[model samples]
Target chain A: MADKVLIYSRFPKTMMTRFAEAFELLDTAGKPAHEVFPAEELAGVRAVLTAGGTPLGGAEMDRFPKLGAIVCYGTGYDGVDLKAAAARNIAVGHSPGANAASVADIAMTLMLAATRRILVADQYVRSGDWAASRQSPMMRPQAGMPSRRIGVYGMGEIGRKIAARCAAFESEVGYFSRSRHDLPYQYFPTLEAMADWCSVLMVAVRASAETNHVVNADILKRVGADGFIVNISRGSVIDEAALVAALTDGTIAGAGLDVYAREPHVPDALTALPNVVLSPHIGGHTLDSHVAMQNCVLANLTALFDGKPLPHDVRPEGKTA
Target chain B: MADKVLIYSRFPKTMMTRFAEAFELLDTAGKPAHEVFPAEELAGVRAVLTAGGTPLGGAEMDRFPKLGAIVCYGTGYDGVDLKAAAARNIAVGHSPGANAASVADIAMTLMLAATRRILVADQYVRSGDWAASRQSPMMRPQAGMPSRRIGVYGMGEIGRKIAARCAAFESEVGYFSRSRHDLPYQYFPTLEAMADWCSVLMVAVRASAETNHVVNADILKRVGADGFIVNISRGSVIDEAALVAALTDGTIAGAGLDVYAREPHVPDALTALPNVVLSPHIGGHTLDSHVAMQNCVLANLTALFDGKPLPHDVRPEGKTA
Candidate 1:
């Protein structure tokens, strides 16, 4: 029999074609993989391709008795049960750093859109308000990027890219990361210190159990009434409830958010607030990123079937399995 | 008599207070100087402070017989009749390069907004479409700033700033201007050739009779189906009707416009198109630019009154009068 593989994520037609050439494709996109396929149909499944939203726990892995590897479709693999996979001696692979540039671009997009109030300006021009009034409403004056201080919460690849872009606009760039790199930018040891020093605070940390709700009320308070915050990292990295309160009480000036605590479900309070710019989690939804990630998934799967080391294996905590 | 000055534009209270200390202020804001002010009121007007929109011609100058200078509020003085001012020996002063950074900021804002489809994304999230659909609408994939060619139409102060910012995003920057500069960017002698070579074409040329309708149907045709155009310069620099048709057909991908041919009157046809992002001539409407321009205006007026050479004098074409 042909080596069978289960696909638990939606992919473009081209990527599906590539998968078909290598294995017998069993698609369970937009549904729970365990529930979608019968026991007999999943019996010979040796590997699975999943997206970030699909939870692959011990229970799901138990279904595929011959399962050898699980490849995540995107850079983020938070939903994948790494500990469970490690215990089962099954390899876990993910496309790491594939969408860094795209996510950084979205971070800048949200920053500019929120600060410049582009949505409000577009509405003013489109609704005949500009024509009727013949004058732009006197809005709070926007401070441009030049000479302003920007504090990045995480200084990984994405954060570094964001800082580089901000620096080109003549912004003073600073960062807060767990350990300092050899970068020229000033490194703040704590999040609150970075918030206090910068006018615009950007969150770009990775999401893990330890990092959950890292940016809470205290950090927002330190950012204060004149500062802006932009979040392009995982939604769990920030305390959404604290953010809502900050925006409501004017503890911070404004925010640009791409991720939410709940997938596809944003709080009504955030939508109602005028001080926030919201976009569906689309930071890595570019064509270039998608193709790169697809290639990564293919590479991981090829390496696994050939009985070679996975190109992007995920480790449990501080140790590699 | 205190040196009488006619304020032909609406200025901030602070600017007006400063003007009051230097002249007998004749505030003609929101009213035509020739029609609203009688002969008696305009007789002793020794100078006029106006914006780019307020035309200062020989006829308006005739009302202010003692007018020694006309100080323009913003950088562009297209509305002011330079030849007429030269003929009447009325010195003209304007704030050159005052809003270059701000305008360049807006140019990048539009380019990113259009390419990323930010307005549509904002609408998608705000309307709860993401919650209902659970997936973003699979539109054409966005190719980001990195590895893209950006063609700047004019390489003045604003264009240079824009090029520097694009470079930071890893875009290959090119320019088309009447003459060459010492910059390292590739120079395209013709606009059509630049359009063909670039994915994003930014129009930043100053509007004059010679440069009116510079980006017409021919240029848009060369920009083709996958390209975007950004205009932070004067509206008349583009042929609006041609742009409307190109956007309707698939001749060009999209546009980010901050100006229109008619003040406060955006065409209904242009408004109906989903491909364009529009703002009401607010490229330089920032607090920083405003204060800088105000200081420039003040300096020019002070110099003229104190019998010093005009700091930012506008000489007539090919003649210094």
Candidate 2:
């Protein structure tokens, strides 16, 4: 018997059909993706594929009696309740290394935007105020600073990629991670050390119970008034309130944020700051990444039907790899 | 006797004093710097210090009889007449590496702004038409495309730096120069070949008599409708007419430009296009670069006085080492 796959989010019709052509697809259409999971839609579904807005929780897993697995379409699995899925003996898998390059590209994009003041300069040019702005004593530095030190909070694929780009600018790169890896640059013993060493800090770690609020008030203070921050990882990685306070008081230079604590609904404080550059949580929403991620889903589905080990299974709290 | 250095362009008091402290400075305070040479102000001047703006053509050089060397406070030496300097045995020097990193940083900035549709998105967001504008069909793939091939047109200092940063995105890099070097990536024989291999192309080559309009109508057309172009080197390297035509017809994807055919002035054709990102020719304008270039000027002064080989001498065709 064919493995039945249920797509739980709104996706491109062409791509959905590409997956459906290979599986016994169970249709679940026009259901507001982010609305709480419908009980009726879970009836007899063997597996579900979802991402971002369509979060799958504990109670929803209980509805599917014969559900063997859940596949997240992207890297971040925060929306999916991994612990609950584990308790139900349901496998949870994600598309790791799928959008690694895409996320890395955006991370560098944000870093460059923050460092070079692209938005400010572009605004000056568009407003027909380039000449006036140049003459205006109000303008600080139109060009980016040279020879800055860059600090990376995570040493994963995306973080390392950002580090590589930073190093190309001849910036000294120092990183903080759980375990030390052999890198071209030095590794700091702690995030505080990393923060103290750099005027530009980039946070690219995972968001979990163990890592939430890793960049807090104390760390923000350590970054100081001369430093800038860029959060491309998760909104929870940074203490948003602390960020707001620091930004308002001019305790930190500026920030470029791709994610937020409450995304698609940013705080008024952040949006009001002239120094900050904010984007909706669409960093990984590139055509290249979407296609790559969907292909990963195909591989995971193929493996499940073949009774083989899934490629990127998220183990339970203490389960063996 | 202390070597007398003439200060031409106006600078901050502190910066002027700082330069003076390094050498015996001639303060052309009341009189216009241009009038100084033919007038009594040229009496004891041994060296001249000027920014990139001061015109030091053949006629101007005829008046500075005792001038042994000139230190350009910026990278480009367009205002200096090469033939006149060579004829009179007056060494002409410029700051090269001083601005490489700065230019590379802003080059990448324009690339990101153009590629990610930042300017357009900003306009869309601020107009309160976010919903309508975003929902409108765009030719762009998405926020950022990943794993696509990237091409660099001159593999010199700034170009190589841009390439190194591009590598961080896991972009397969291909480059075109007069001759291939032993770089980490493949080398394309021509610009057309490079464009054929890449979805994004960056023009970081020199602009000169031979290289003028190298990226003309044919090359732009060859790059195709799905490719993007970034020019940070010199505006003359690209055919402005061809670029305008391409952008108008959508023969190429998009463009990010720093230099222009007529600078301090931009063409309405480019500004009118929603797909282009434009910046004034300030790619190498940074505090660090300014200081570094000043130091290069000092080096040129020292070398000329001590009868040593001047570093970074501008050639007949304007290439520097």
Candidate 3:
């Protein structure tokens, strides 16, 4: 008998199908693979390979009597019940550092778009008012440059990359991290301080319980009316209600967000603000990034099937059981 | 009697009024300064300072019997007919090198805004479609770093500044010029070649008969569907008709224009496109740029008042007239 594998991601099936031909592949895309055990369908399964959305808990693990390992197919393993897997003596492997560059690129794009008012210009041209309104006083304000101070709320790989990019434009790059590093730029002691100092604040931190609501009403107010905020890390990083209120009340200049509090669901307040630039959670969805992440998944999948210790394993703990 | 000065630029009167505390200022923002020489407002004038739109043409120069100097209160001298002024021994001074940094800043802002689809996402948020389309496919396209080729059409001060900003994003920068100089990036032999090589092109060349229609249909076609064009220099630098056709046919992806072939007039075809981004030719209009340009005008005015030779003069002849 061949080793069984499960996949749960928005990857091209052709790539996975080719890999499956070489092994006992059980794909779960449109429908859960019957041969592979989904949490609810877990029965006599030896191992599992899943995405961020599939929640594997203690209840499901009980069904897989002989399960030894679970492989997360992406960089984040937020949905996995790691503690339950650890208690059952099952190892969990995950891919890391694969989509950092792509995520960084998205962050910069959002920042540039929001700061420069690209969409506003588009409307001006498309509405047939550009020529007649060219000399209008309303047109005069469009002729300016980006703000001086730039703030990054996270000092992770993506945040660091964005900082380096901002430096190229001669923008004063400042960052808020767990512990300040000796970077070429300034490092604020706290996120609120960073917001206070910078005119453009970008959130590149992760989405976790401890880090939730890091950018709330108080922080947004500190950012002030002349400032801008961008969140590329996670939707939970910012309180959406506070952000909308700030934008509505002119507490801050504008915002650029790639992720929201809920996936595939955006709040009406954020959607109603002309100042905010919002993109679906796509900070890590570039072609280059997708290919990189998929390759990492393949590497881990190949390692697990060979019955050897995985290169990137998550010691399951403190997850929803 | 105090020397008479005619102000032709539509600047905020408050600023001019403050500066005029030292001079016999004749305000002509809305109406002609003097009805006696309506056509030649500079007639019997010691110095003349005109804004961005007022063109001092050949026929008008013949009437300025007492005009000692003409001062362009902005960097672009296209509005002033230098050769005509020179023929009559009238010195014309312009504010060159004044707005280089500001113009460069706006050019980069436009590039970043267009490439990242910033404005489009903003509309998405403002239209109350966030929840239904939070994870829409359009939003996902900009999730990571953009790895696209960028081209600069001019290699002057503004062009170089744009190049510096482009390199900051790790974008491959290439350029075209009348005569290529040594630079870190690649230099294409022709505009078509540059277009072929880049997914985004910035037109930063001066608008002269030589540069008119430089970006024709062939160049647009070379730019292809994946490419975009940005013009921060002059409108005539691009062939507007060809551009309209290219956009309509999808020969190029889109454009971000700050200048139009006709001042204060945009073409219907160009205006109808949703992809295009337009601003009312305010690329070099900034607070810093205005101060620098005004200082240049002041220099020319002072030179005329003192009967000294004018600096930054534009003599239209191949040689100084």
Candidate 4:
């Protein structure tokens, strides 16, 4: 008999096909598992597969006394309630750095799109502005990437990839992380110091309660009126209200955002601005990243079924945000 | 006394302020010099400063008997009639490689934008489609940058920079140029072979009469339905009609174009498609690139007036394109 694994989050049925082949899936379909499955079925569930963002606390974990593992679909596992999982001795697993390259690719994409004003240029040609010989301040020449300073807020897998790409463009790279790693980029003691020094502040920091709204009015101001902010990490890292104000009043030149304070519902004030290049939260949404992450999930689940430690278990201190 | 430099093309007065300070003012404002100025003034013209695309043939050159030099503002001097300049013993100068980095940056921008479907994702967020959980085939995962084959169609300054950036992303790099250079990337003997081998074909070949429409329907077909075409070189290099058909019929996946076959007047057919990310020939239009190009122009003009060789002169064999 296949080991029963509860699908705790809502995903398109297609994404669940692989897990269904290996295990008996009791899909809650984004509802409370107890509501979908009776007490007898819940007691037999040995594991849970979920999106990293969905909140799974101690109360939920207790529903399945035999639950030995929790496997996150992507790199992030912020809402897993690490303490609760630890107290109940649930081995947590995640696909670390599986989506880093894709996330970094979007970071570069957003940075170039915002800094080069490609979106504005696109409209300029489309709206007959260029043909009419119409002039706008927006068409003014922009500085190139060479020798520009790029400050990364975090120095994890995604940040390192971003830094490497910046370096290849001949831009100076700097970063501020929890602790300085022995990397080629210059280390800053604080995000403010790095923000002041670099013209393009790239937020790749892992999000936490402590990091909520870390990139506020002060950081935006420090980035200077000519600077830009590119955030690919998480939405809560920035104070969206402050970002809106900064963009409105020219505290910063532009922004390229993938994440938002509220998922799927970005404030209208942001969408109204021309300087921003906004994208839905799909940073790690790539074919290769998905396959890699799925492999990790499968590996973790197989290990748990075999009574072995997860090959890609998340450490308590290094929980993915 | 200031040297006489007849401004041959239309430019806003602000852009001419710097040139006006160094040269005797005879602003034609894009009109023919003979129409704007008397024969006596035209005879005294020592140099001509014009855009590289405006036609400057033997007939035009014959009017300026005293013209010592033809200096191009930006790269591509295709309109200068290089043969005519050589026949007249005129020194031709341009800002060689001054904007290579910027052009390469745009190539990367277009590649990422088109491949990752950033614009689609942006629309998804802005239109509340994401909130409604709308489904799109485009929202399907994309392959990450790592190990992806990137074939550069030209191995010039711009192509070299693009290859280096792609390498940093851990992408496999290949190229096909007229003459092979000592580079780390794999070189193909022909464009077709490279196009078939690479998933992303970056068009950076210099535009010339012989190279016009080099990337035709056949080339587009070889790029395959899953591949992309990024052209930052010149509009003349690709068959715009074939490109339109290919894009419409899904002969190729997508394209990122900076230049079109016609200036400022793109066919409505091309603009109607959602697969392309279009820009109006703004590849080298950056503040830093402009400043660098201007310095080269200044050096070329000053050298001509001082009875010295043009420092940034275009050799007969190495005309800017």
Candidate 5:
């Protein structure tokens, strides 16, 4: 019999095909663990696989006495009760930087789509507004990328990639991070200062208690009426209500979002707006990213099964929750 | 008093505001020259301003016997009868490379949007499909930009900018231009070879008789079903029927087009497809680009009125017709 692993969060069956081949997966399909498996079955579970944003706490860990590892599917592990896992002597592992390139690619996609008014232009051609020589407010010539200010909120892997791409387009790149790094981009003392200086604010900060709702109304005001905000990081970083109001009242020009405060439940107010470009939370959903993350997960899981330390362990500093 | 200048094409009044201040304009508003202005107005017109895509043949020049200078408003002079101007002892001037950066920006926007399926994702979010956790083919993981082959079909101003932008995204860049330059990108001898080698074909070639329909069925076949094409060059450079068929039959995965073979009259078959991202021919339409082009236009006209050589004269080789 194969070693069993519990699926702690909902994921598509296709994504689990390779994992299924390697182990007997106790798939709960996002249901309560007790409802899906007997206590004996749970007791035999030595490792659990989970999505990064699913809530997993010490209470859940205590239910499985044999539990030795918690593995995150992607770069983030914010929802894992890291402190509790550490206290329980369980090794936590995540695929760091596996999805950074894809996330950065989506950031540029959202920025360009929103800034170019591409959707509006598409409708113009499709609706015959362009053919009829109609005048639209959006048809007014937009400012090009040259000399446009792009401010990144973090200096992590994704933020660095975004800054590099923006710089290639001849945009001026700047950043506000917790600590200054040796990157080529200009550094700002605070997020407020960067927001005030940049035309486009790219939110790539990691999710933490301090970062929750950090980009509130005040930051939006600092971004100004002519500026744009693009968030590819956790939606919790932005106060959703404040962002909607800012977009409605023109406190900011527009927004491009991939993540929301709640997954799979975007507010109708946001979907109804013309000035926003919205996507489902899929910033890291590329094929290459998935493969890379799977390799890391495999490495971590193989280590645990062999009674060894996780080679891809989540750093101690990452144990926020 | 401002010098009399004939406006041979229709343009938005706002776009002409600055020029109106510099010239006494006899606006044809895209009507026949003879119908809009009398013989006296035509005879008095020494300089005519025109959009680069509007057809201006020698027959039209005969209508304005005293017309000494034909100034194109944008970078291209493909539609101007350059040989006729040369034969008539008339100077042709254009704003060369004024809109390269803006055009290149839109090129990247279209490439990223179409390749990433931004429109499909947008619809999935708006229709509550994402909220319902529905499966979409478009939601399947896509390839990231790293090491992806980007083949630019021309190495002109816009092409160079596109290559630079793609390089910043960490893609493998290549080109098939008329002549080789000292750029770091790989050079393919022909479009067919590049089409086979690259995953994304960026159409940035100059429009000419020799280049018309150069990217036909065979070229698109080499691009394969997983590939994409982005055209920012003139509409006549592509074979429209073949492109539509290829898109429908999955000969190629998708296309992002800013120009069409027929400008205002796109076929319904082409517009109804879900795989293409369409835009009006607004590649060079940006405030900064226009300002730069207008300054060139201002210089060309100023030199013409002063009986000096047009400072921005069209080179003899651009006389396509």
Candidate 6:
């Protein structure tokens, strides 16, 4: 019999068909694998294909006695129980740096839309207000991007790309990272210092327990009344409640958000506020990025089935191969 | 007596106050001088402060026998009867290059919004469709900026700036202009060829009789089904009927328009389309650009009143100082 592999997430049909050629693929997407598959059905499963959202834990792994590898389709495998997998001697693999360009594009898109009042402008035209008033009330005379300071909270691949695009618009780019990379952008050791120095604060850090709520009320206050904040990273990287309060009280000028603390459940407070631009969490969810991620997953699974080291191994300490 | 100047358009209160410091200001912003001013009241008018929308024709010029100069507040004096002014020995001045940066910024904003389906995404989140569907239908897997060809219809200051920004996004920039400019971007002498070569065609040419309807059905068809068009220049530069037809018939993929053939009157057909992003003619109406334009207008008026040559003299043959 062909080697059995459990598919824990939905992939493109073409990719799934390609995988099916080499293994007996069992799909359990959008439902618990334990609930979807009986013990006997999962007994021969030696590999699993998953995503950042549908992670495999010890309980799920214990059901599959022959499981040897867990390959995640995209970056950020935070949902996976890495310690549990490590103790069980199961290898973990995930795609990294696969969606940086799309995320950076969305980051800049949010910034420009929020700063330029695109949503308001579109409404002004659509509502026939422009014809009646003969002027755009959406014009905030002080709003512009040129020569403004843009503070990035992280200087990883996505952050660096965002900074590069901002530079082309004549913005002064600065950043706060754990350790200074050899980048030409001005470096700040603390988020507060960067917020104080910038007119636009961009949150682009990876989400984790240590980085959770990095942009709290203090950072918002430092960003101040004329400042704008944009978050394209994971929602956990920012304190959403504090951000909403700051926006409500005018601690900051405005915001552009692509992620929320409880996604698809944006607070009524944020939805009711006119000073924020809200989007569903779609920063890295582009067709090109999806294809890259699928390719990475296939490569990892292929390498594992051949008894070779996984191409993008993830460890318990948050390190990637 | 301070030389009397007739204000034909509404300027910012601050700008008008500054002009008041130098001249005996007569405000007729929304009304005709004939309706607002009696014959006696118009007798001493030695200059006219107008916008492109308010033309100074022979009849208006005859009313003010002492009129020596027509100072326009912004660029695009196509509406002003330059021959009539020149024949009467009345010099013409306008603010040139004042709003280039702002217009360039908006051009990029529209491009990103249309290509990335920002307006639709915003609507998706706002209408709770994202929450219900849990995924965006706006994701076109092949959509991106990297390695794409951006064909600029004009190589003016704003066009060059737009190209610079597109370059930072890794787009290949090309242009179609009447004559070659001293730039590194590929130049096509014909619009049809450029449209064929580009995935995104940008309209940035100035409005004039010869340039009217430059981007018609032929060019749109050449751009094909996978292409997008962005216009930040005058609405007359395009054939609106052909564009609407093409957009309706799917001859082109999408469009981002900031200007319309008729001011304040967008066709229901254009507004009803889903693949286009529409905005009012506020591309260069930012506060920074307004201030710059006002400053330029003031400098030009001051020079004309001081008996010095106009700083930005717009002649009948489309030449400027």
Each model's DockQ? 0.70, 0.44, 0.43, 0.76, 0.80, 0.59
Model 5 alpha-carbon miss at residue B321, Å: 8.3
Regions of model 3 farther than 4 Å from truth? A1-75, A79-97, A134-147, A309-321, B1-5, B9-42, B51-55, B124-130, B133-146, B306-321
Q: Across all candidates, what is each one's fraction of true contacts kept?
A: 0.65, 0.44, 0.55, 0.75, 0.79, 0.50
Candidate 2 collision pairs: none
TM-score of chain A of each: 0.93, 0.88, 0.86, 0.94, 0.97, 0.91
Interface RMSD of 4: 1.2
Deviating ranges (above 4 Å) for candidate 2 = A1-6, A9-17, A23-41, A52-54, A131-133, A136-146, A305-309, A316-321, B1-17, B22-38, B42-46, B52-55, B121-146, B302-309, B315-321
Query: Could you give the candidate ranking by DockQ, starting with the highest?
Result: 5, 4, 1, 6, 2, 3
* Best-matching candidate per lDDT: 5
Candidate 2, A65-163: lDDT as tens digits? 778888888887777787788788788788887787777767767777766666766655656676443553323443353567888988987788788
Q: Across residues A1-321, which tens digit of lDDT does each residue of candidate 6 receive?
A: 567889887554555776788778899865777788898889888888886655567987898888889888767776678788888889988888888888888888888888888878777777777667655544546556774799999888889989999998878899999999898899998988999999999988877768889899999999999889999887888889999999999899889988888766787788887777877777776767777777787788888879988888876355642
Candidate with better TM-score, 1 vs 6 = 1
The per-residue C-alpha lDDT of model 6 at residue B309 equals 82
lDDT of 4 by residue, A99-161 (tens): 999999999999999998888888888788888888978988887898478999998899999
lDDT of 2 at A89: 79
The residue ranges of model 6 lying beyond 4 angstroms of the native Cα positions read: A1-3, A10-24, A53-56, A134-137, A314-321, B10-17, B53-56, B134-142, B315-321
For candidate 6, the chain B TM-score comes to: 0.92
**Model 4 DockQ vs. reference:** 0.76
DockQ for candidate 1: 0.70
Interface RMSD of each: 1.2, 3.1, 3.6, 1.2, 1.1, 1.8
Worst 10 residues of 4 chain A by lDDT: A312-321
Give the winner by DockQ: 2 or 4.
4
Query: lDDT per residue, candidate 2, B1-321, as tens digits?
Result: 677788765544555666677678776542465665545556556677776545677676655668887777767666576678878888877787788888888888888767877666544443435433245344244635445678899988888888887776567888999998999988999888887778788888866567788888988888888778888887778889899999889998788888877655567777788888877666876778767777887788888778787776665355442
lDDT by residue (A195-236, candidate 5, tens digit) is 999999999999988899999999999999988999999999
